[model samples]
Target: MSEAKGHPPVFAIHLTSSATDGTRVLAVGAEGPLSADLTDEVAELCRTADDPGRAGAVQVLPRPLRTPARVVVVGVGAADPAGWRAAGAAAVRAARSDEKLQVVVPPQTSPEAVRALAEGAWLAGYRYRDAPDGPRSAEVDLITDDAGHAPALDRARALAQAVWWARDLTNAPASIKNPPWFADQVVAEAATRPGLTVTVRGPDELAAEGFGGILAVGGGSATPPRLVELSWRPDGATRHVVLVGKGVTFDTGGISIKPRESMKLMRKDMGGAAAVLGATFAAADLGLPVRITTLAPLAENAVSGSAFRPGDVITHYDGTTSESTNSDAEGRLVLADALGYAVARLDPDVVVDVATLTGANAVALGKGMAALYSHDDDLAAALTAAGDAAGERMWRLPLPEDYLEYLHSDIADRHSSPARGAASVVAALYLREFLGDRVDRWAHLDMSAPSWADASDGDLTKGATGWGVRTLVAWLGALGR
Candidate 1:
């Protein structure tokens, strides 16, 4: 419940052969470990406790034991990367009050498992607060005799840092996070990385460039809108991937209006942009051999006399016309301009856009998964595999050609938010119209459901989840390789 003024510290991780003089964490398998490399008293206590060893289950010893006074036992069901990740997260949460921890790495664990463990622990330890009483900083030591796992740990640390940065950006209050402010934050962050370059377009530039969709959606707010173009062009990079993110800093549904309850979490409407920025930063930090271009369209959809209304026909960046059927569907409108620009200017091998575009995504997939739509099977499969590896699961939805008729508008080339049912699909179809002939290279992620968590889960806190970051980072890493 406490707040902190600045970013929280990332967990300090080290590789060691034995437990440090602090909290010692032991892992238990689903069937119970046949032999645990632990003190006799600790092992006996674990047995007497009757722990089931299910993934994410944690148990803390009641009494202090030896050099490492505190002891915590976590469950790693099936002993896979997912299980190890869950176990690592559970152990860290159980001993969150402790400043130091020694986590026992299972014997002969693969580098993937080690990376998962480090990522889980680092991510679980993240807290966004503005007071001195917030979550305390902690350091973790992965107890293992092998030195080869160090590289994996390093990669995990970088990925975790990227996710944490996304969470911070998404969780920031809307009052202080307008479009220009968001652009400033991203520009400042990109300045620190040597390989990244950021160019921000303000209201004047947007209007001059004929980005009507972005201008229309942002007209209601006094602060105006911004389009941030972030690029990372590494030498000798072969593939160019363009990422577009919807950055509705706060959405009041803009004249269509959301319920008061729905507006409570509108601050996180920029979650997609946060994820894009995070992935781009991660690529630079990890020195990935891929040319990456990120387009973030930022605006605040607030209610005012100047707000664009339903039935208004607006021209987009590529001269395409769209009739707004519902102002609440503003995310897709802004994204249309960015996608149009990406297709027109950036000649990339792949284009992926992430957005919290529809509430129907939550209705269909619930809060733990995102809805993925793509015409390209290879890209879909690649993203699905990356999500599986990164713990950010996504379900690919069918983009039926028959649904294209639903977007038919009498006044314009397309209708934004044309149909009521299959809302997520309709939104995806609307955005697809902007991709031009590059439709096969485009993929859309409606991450509304998973972008913000209502409850704390493994590697996810209750607020902004930073959902797409890990998946995007994983996919980019694979592409670079």
Candidate 2:
């Protein structure tokens, strides 16, 4: 955890294949480097090596150029973010088990490539490593010649650190990351920064203020529920943006319990809250000018006698009634309350909510992409552009005004979920009811797919991918421009 300070060192890259100390990594694209740049020995090795550069390709040799003890050449086809990230991560795997290494930045490397390289190397090296004897790797160094790249490198490292922070929180066990603990962490973070204000509301206050969704779902657990509101307002900032995250510390599906197999990874159900919180921290770290507020509705959906039941009707913060036809559809319930509170109280110029709400999102976009649904085209475009720049791919899904009919309820205003297909779209539609014309610049990110990964790829580790944070931070940074 102490390694969270900064990025591993990277040095300025040179074209010559001279040997150096420790492990040295070289970047090779589809079109291999110029023949003149390689030493005679290294050039001969390249000829003997299988296909110099293809996507995700790597070739390792023992002192080919006679400088370093070992050398690795990684393929980065097309030099896109994914390719660069893979190359950086591949370098981590190719290095000595416990040695510090240097990575050679390719000539004419784009800013995005730099970010991908830093993010991949740093994230791949992350470990819970709380114990003294846990496996650890030396710092990674990126070689860069231009002093102009320093600022951008610093920003990239900060963003990667924030992602790592979120990943740690998401990977934590539910026993230690309950609602109160989560609130305390949020408060502790806010205390460290100026111009930031944090407010926590407990179960009693939530009940008094009519946050029925949070209360009902949290009632089943002894840990209770909490609402954390964080605001950062710098002087002269006129535009305000609100980010709402669904903080279900652990989800058991309440009265409509999930199967044993499906409940195993429920600890990551709060990935949305962690992601937005990470973005807030990143924005503060970068000193962005736009005002930002993050709302986290913290709760645990457990099974108990008092657990809310299907077919129960609850009144939300916006005075809208929703019937819980399926208790498993609880993420939207908490998010609805936060969305209403943000629009009614903060009146932000833009609103974006993140949640691991539905499996349908994974069914549609798979685990590598997040589903983005929005009513505002401009807002959607901006977010997509920001996501592209940050290497977080978000695919837009239609809200389908016609799909609103699926949420119809016989006894209440709407149903928590639809009975049949289009579950992801229906969930987004359910949240839209809370906006009620007060907010137009809004986007809902269903992070069920990209929130966690089964295996490590690029800079993302095997668990808690830290999905939405980078995209939101990038978007917030681009707000004024």
Candidate 3:
């Protein structure tokens, strides 16, 4: 866990035909001086994984002079940056078993490629070695150039590592990461970092503060709901940005119970919370001059006697009443309150909220892409540009002025969720009511699809993907635009 301090190290390895002189190079292609150390490390990595097979595409090498240092022969999948990063992440994991080793990646990679390598390595190397732990890989080595701006690279490392921390929390099992625990984690982080102040608003404070939306959604859970606020404004910072996240630790769909299979991955429903925290830490480590306050409405969406029902109408702190269309759509409810609080209290120039808010987003963006909703054209464009730079996919979805009409509920101020078909779009429109005319400057990301990985890509692992932090950090850096 001590390795959590910085980004993982990676080496640039050279592949050679005659590397068979002694070392079992898991050489995937031509070896050269640049990648020598990396090839040796990859061999060691493969050996450590302890698989009896070493398959390289169209390459033959003499077998076993010894344990074979885990021959993870990777194929030249594509000329794309993603492939190289996947290779980098794969190398880190495959070489991981040995106590602290370095895996080499492509040397002539682009800036984005280097970032992808670091992102994937740190992400893949993450292990929540803290909780009642057993045997695990102690640390990982990521090699980078000593030249250029070392300070900036160090900052990059910190940002990537912070993303790692956030991912670790998101990937943690629900048993260890409920509402109170999450609040404590945030409190601890805020306390440890300089230039940060945190506040935890429990059920009583929520009720007193008129956070009816968060209260109603989490009221049924065994654990009470909490509203967590983390503020950072170093000395003379200029811009202030507010980020809100839906922190439903384990959603049972409440009175609107989902099928068992549907509820299995509910722990990851808090992916938005993870993103906010990750972005905050990364911004701090990157030393962004902008002031930031992150709002994570921590709650466990459970099924209990106190849980709000489908027909129930609850009034939020913002004085907006919403009829429960489906208790499962509770994320948006909690987020609505958080967003309102952020706007009213922080009064930042811009606000953004992230959440695993809908299955409909998945239908529209599929598994690897996230859906971006924004009334502000500039905000949407910024986010899209950042996504392009960061290699995270976020396609913009319009929050049409007319779509707001669909949220009409004769019995209440609005419906918790609109009817099916255009669910994700309507959900965005629903949030617009709380944002009001200021919506012209705000953005919301429906990360339901990419919140959790269905498969591993080059640098992205097969679990909590740390999906939005890079794009978010990039977007925040481009704020004035």
Candidate 4:
């Protein structure tokens, strides 16, 4: 037990043999035998726990040895980076109090595994409630024999904090996170930051600037719509990247309306915007050398007399007209406007758009990964590699040229909703039209599946997953300093 009741826990990393003798928490993987330092009694108690070697399994008992007060053994089934993260996260959650915690770094743990363990613990520590709770308990320390891994752990902490920021934004209630409010947060971020500039355009400006997609979808809500642009350029940066996010704060399927059950989680429709915000902030904080521009078209898809209806025609920012065939297909409309604005205004070396755009994406890729569509193979490969490195999985789905016809509408340039078959790819194709031929290296991440997790696991809680933030940050970091 911790000596103090409310004091934040202290985290330290130590070699298994060097763990301090005191009342403490010892986190270890179940794959191996107990450390030789542990007394025979503690080892016997651990072996008594059935199937302790299974992933996510846990066994906690009073320390029979002269060391810590309690020993918590967590199962890192495969002893991989992901397994280590899950083990660390589960151990932190299972621990009863904020006490001095020491995690024994597995002898075979790679630097990446060390980072994962740190990130897992860091993320599990976050709790979002409206009440003014006091600060969280002490920090977690990683005990390792090698001192060289400290810098990597520091970097991981920063990245995990960025993810936490995104999760907070995404988890915010839609009533409090409307378009104007979301824009306000960007303005506030820019006000405090040094290298970032934020520009927000309201409904009047959006209409004047020909952002009909945003205006049309936002017309039903009293909150209006906004196009938020954030630009960050560090000194001596050569490469440029533009990121666009669909910020539908809440979606009710407009006039089409959604089933009651389907509408419950619509507040997370702004997950893409949250991700880009987090990634941009992370890049700025880390002092990455690549110039980055983030665009979020913020709106609410509500139902009212003014709501855009089926068969309505909308001219997007790039002068491409679209027919609103299904009001539920609103994400692509807002994203199309931002994507066009990025290509037309920024002229970056590459463009990427993230959106919780389609239910079909959940069906195509399941909940484990996002559906990735790219215009250029090199950019696609680079993003895939980045996602792999960041532990966010992406599956490349082709933007079949043949699917373009599904978007054709007799009254307008195209239809917002295409045929239901291959729906996710069709949505991506619709966005590609707005990019035009001028942009070569472009990619779309349909993040519906990965944007929110159904239950808490590993580094994620049961709300917004903040999935793309890490992947985007990793991609930018890999672009070189």
**Residue 261, model 2, lDDT:** 92
How would the candidate models be sorted by lDDT, starting from the highest? 1, 4, 2, 3
- For residues 291-378, could you state the per-residue lDDT of candidate 2 as single tens digits? 9999999999999998999999999998888999788899999999999888889988999999999999999988888889998999
Model 2: residues with Cα > 4 Å off, grouped in runs:
1-38, 64-67, 80-82, 106-113, 129-138
Local lDDT at 34 for model 1 = 20
lDDT of 3 by residue, 1-481 (tens): 1223343322223232223468544443433423566455556554554331222121212224332222345433443445544544565655535434454444454565555555555666566545646533235554554344355446557767766767778888999888999999888876777777888999999999899988998899788999988887866777788898889999888888889999888888998998888888878767677889999998888888888988789888788899987888899889889887776777788888889889888898899888998877877888889887776889888666776677778999988776656898888888877886567778889998888876655556667877788888888777634
lDDT of 1 by residue, 37-143 (tens): 43454556555554435667666654433334456767666667888788788877776453466676756778998899888888887888545486523456677
Q: Worst lDDT window (10 residues) for model 3?
A: 52-61
lDDT by residue for model 4 (156-177), tens: 7778877887888898898798
TM-score, model 4 to reference: 0.88
Q: Tell me how far the alpha carbon of residue 359 in candidate 4 is from the true structure, in angstroms, after superposition.
A: 0.6
Off by over 4 Å in 1: 1-38, 48-51, 96-99, 129-137
Q: Cα RMSD to native, each candidate?
A: 6.2, 5.8, 6.7, 5.3
How close is every model to the real structure, measured as TM-score?
0.90, 0.89, 0.82, 0.88
* Decoy 2 TM-score against native: 0.89
lDDT of 3 at 174: 92
Model 4, CA-based lDDT:
0.80
User: What ranking emerges by TM-score with the best candidate at the front?
Assistant: 1, 2, 4, 3
